[model samples]
Target: MRLRVCGICIQNERILLINHSLYGKDTFFWSPPGGGVQFGETATEALEREFLEETGLRVKVGKLLFINEHIEAPLHAVEMFFQIDSFEGTLKTGEDPELSAEGQVIEQVQFLSWDELTQFAPNQLHRIFSMIGSLDGVFHLQNYIPGQNSGLEK
Candidate 1:
């Protein structure tokens, strides 16, 4: 499993997210700005870099919101979700350097309101978001398990 750090950035009642299509596969994922933590880099450092690369925003990482053990065949990540205390930059679609130009997964970058998120199926979104009743509940998350964030169980 890999360790990943994701930033929860909220501004003006909307949240930053990326529309990512898996390379060489017919799948799409809507998730926050985040990625694998590189060796020697702190989790906050990784989150900061990831936010800039994925959302075109420079962010200051805040408190740890929750920890999630994401489990899907072929991918299992121990993800750390942290609050983005602040940010500054024009929002824009960004690229994932890990993928080839032709296989880039990032399809769009957007700031979406809570209601906007409900339109997508739980499986289409990151598990952390798939379960929340309100955006404010995101800040209350602490430790997350497999089914807890998927609305299958608490």
Candidate 2:
């Protein structure tokens, strides 16, 4: 099972996202710049690496925001979302090659205004953004029953 942690690097009313070009998809789905936790790295470390690689910024991860369990995602896809409060550096695309993930190279790496964020796929993220105030109540644990199936028969 693989464990990954990502952070929503929000600044100046805009959020950081990557435009992925994998699986033959032409359009982009918005996601925070984050990736899998390595064998020995902590969640904060992984986030710092991913952010630097993808967005070219040094981030200060603040608090754990959400933990998502996706039955439909690939194997062992547990994601932790965090609140990043502070950072240093100019935001750009693919400034750190070492931090790039598979199929994730910075193309349009700038802060997207709130209105701009709506022009992406998976509309639920919009609600996710609105619900940021209730961050503590947003995390849902799915299909954790020991014997029973998760019932995520999608």
Best lDDT goes to which candidate?
1
Q: Taking the candidates one at a time, how many backbone clashes does each contain?
A: 0, 0
Instruction: Give the top-scoring candidate (TM-score).
Output: 1
lDDT by residue for model 2 (51-144), tens: 8877788999987866764444334466777888898998777643544555444455666666776455454242344434332323432223
Kindly list the per-residue Cα lDDT of model 1 for residues 1-154, writing each as its tens digit: 7999988888889988888886335777789889999999999999999988888888889999888897665566899999999999988888888878897888889988999999988878887775678788788887775533333232
What lDDT, from 0 to 1, does candidate 2 have? 0.63
Pairs in clash, predicted candidate 1: none
Show where candidate 1 strays beyond 4 Å: 23-27, 147-154
Please report, as a residue range, the 10-residue window in candidate 2 with the lowest summed lDDT: 140-149
